[model samples]
Target: MSDFATNARLATAALRDLFDPTPLQRNDHLSAQYDAEIWLKREDLAPVRSYKIRGAVNAMRKVRATNPAQQVFVCASAGNHAQGVAYACRHFGVQGTIFMPVTTPQQKIEKTRVFGGDSVDIVLTGDYFDQTLAAAQNFCTDQNAHFLSPFDDPDVIEGQASVAVEMLEQLGRAPDLVVLPVGGGGLASGVTAYMRAESPKTQFRFVEPVGGASLTAALAHDGPTTISRVNSFVDGAAVARLGVCTYDFLKWVDPAHVLLAPEDRICVTMLEMLNVEGIVLEPAGALSVDVLPELSDQIRGKAVVCVTSGGNFDFERLPEVKERAQRYSGLKKYFILRMPQRPGALREFLMMLGPDDDIARFEYLKKSARNFGSVLIGIETKSADNFRQLFDNMGKAGFSFRDITADEALAEFLV
Candidate 1:
């Protein structure tokens, strides 16, 4: 075996002291849908509810092994990475300081504290993640502590490779393809490295959120570059830039093999997994499964593995998830209706609706005209075709309306 592969196996063996390997289960639901042998490496079921713990544990363990007296470790994260680091700190009986943005949800903060127990300290600082990261790094330097990069460090990457090692051992053979969700590229790079050395013929497909496609950008630019904007809906994987260490390992990946999952479309996948498979996946965790339909043709009759990266979804976002899923599936829409400012105008508009159409939101907004007023309306229907009939009927009745569901500015402002 190659040195990297050997080290990955060693990491995997040592990880038994922390937690057992996560499940690699055959998913009949996805397998039947794509006519392939679909297996899910259930990292979501990990104690920390993510594959992040693998990297954190590996990094911390190796650091302690090399410097037995080193007891301080620090990291900055508001999500799974923070929890992972906290869990490792408690397990190894080391002191850890984790920094998170001030805006981070209370649920995440509490979870980190619960995992770390007496072994870690939680610092809430800065309004944004970048600011929080700077604070954490500065503190790390001041304390002479080991700073764990969530995905960029060599030890972290080696620790992540344990996922691939366990996969090979669990499946007893290499699969035809492995679909990985990419954030900072730590898991993808580590898995690819070990898989390439062990299962030389296996192929890979990388999935990134459309709004934060740093890996695709890095491939195009020939190096890591920060993206201009990132949509934070898929917070777990919404990374603005690929890590330099991770990008180096993933540089050989073809740009064509990387797939982008739209943020709204990912909502549909999350709902499907929850409703159909009784699996609750966060937006980032659903990335691998979200791209299955796109690869249906290529994966047919082949064995494929998808890494469902995390399940740290807050139940409070369920309503928003359903709304986005409905929008993406065309079962819901928001529009600005130019209603005549007269008696029984709403009744006339309601009369045009089909039996399956239901009004979800209705608010009258006074626009620049006195004769007519604008109504911000949200409609949900059983079928997308219901909206088509409703629109046609409204047009025939001389009622004019503008669909604002896709109008970013207007939707953000009024809807």
Candidate 2:
């Protein structure tokens, strides 16, 4: 076996001391939908509810072994990595400090605190992650503490490879394909590297959030590079830049194998899993599953595995998730309706509504013309077809309406 494959097995053995291997369960819903055998590597079931704990724990163990006196660990993160590090610090009885952006949600901060307890200290720093990272590094330098990188370090990468080792052992044989979600590329790089050496025939397809396609960017530039803007909705995988160590391992990946998943569309997958399978997945965790429909043809009659990388979803975002799902599925819409200045005009418009349609928002947007006033209307219905029927009826009634659901400027200000 290759050195990476050997080391990965050793890492997996070491992880058995920390936590049992995460489940590799076949998903009937996905299997039936894709007309193939679909298995999920449930990293979400880990103690910290993420695969990150593996890397964090493994890195800490290796560092403590080599350095002997390096008892302090530090990291900067706003999500899973922070929780992973905190959980490790407590488990190892080591002193650890974590820096987080001030804008991080209260729920995340609370979870980190609960996991670390007295073993770790939480530092609320800059508004942006870059500033927080700089602060953490500077503190590490002054305190002579070991900085546990979220993805860029070699030990962390090796630790992540344990996921692949466990997968091979659990599945018995290599699957035809594995779908991995990418952030800074730690997990994807680690899994791919080990699989390439140990299971040469296992094909891989990578998924990244559309707003933060760092892996694709790195492949394009042949190195790690920062993006101008990144939408942080997929907080777990929305990385602005790929990691240097990770990108070096992944630079050879075919750009065509990388798929960009739209941020809003992920909401539909999250809801589907939650409602249909009684499984709750954070946006980033659902990435691999979200791309199933896109890869349905490629995976048909084959065996596939999807790594669900995290489940640290905050229930507070449920309403927003449902809203995005509704919007993406075309079940809700916003539009402007021009109403005549007559008194009964509103009543006449109400009568044209479809049975399944409900008015979610209605406001008079006065137009400059004295003869007519514009009304901003938001509608929620059972099906997209309901909107078509409502539009047809309005057209026949001589009422002019414009769909502003997709108008960025209008929807932002009004919807």
The runs of at least 3 residues in candidate 2 whose Cα sits more than 4 Å from the true structure, single-residue gaps closed, are 367-369
lDDT of 1 by residue, 1-415 (tens): 9999999999999889988999999999999999999999999999989999999999999899999999999999989999999999999999999999999999999999999999999999999899999999999889999999999998899998999999999999989999999999999999999999999999999999999999999999999999999999999999999999999999999999999999999999999999999987889999999999999999999999999999999999999999999999999999988998778977999999888998999988876667799888999999998998999999998888999999889888887
Q: Which 10-residue window in model 2 sums to the lowest lDDT?
A: 363-372
- Cα RMSD for candidates in order: 1.0, 1.4
lDDT of 2: 0.93
Best-fitting candidate, measured by lDDT? 1
Model 1 spans > 4 angstroms off:
367-370
All candidates: TM-score: 0.98, 0.97
In candidate 2 the C-alpha lDDT for residue 7 amounts to 79
Per-residue CA lDDT of candidate 2, range 1-415, in tens? 9888887788889888879999999999899988999999999999999999989988999898888888899999999999999999998899999999999999999999999999999999999999999999999999999999999987888899988998998999999999999999999989999999989999999999999999999999889989889999999998999999999899889999999999889999999999999888899999999999999999999989999999999999999899889889999998999888888988999999988999999988885768888898989999999998999988998889999887868887887
Question: Which ten residues in a row are the worst by lDDT in model 1?
Answer: 363-372
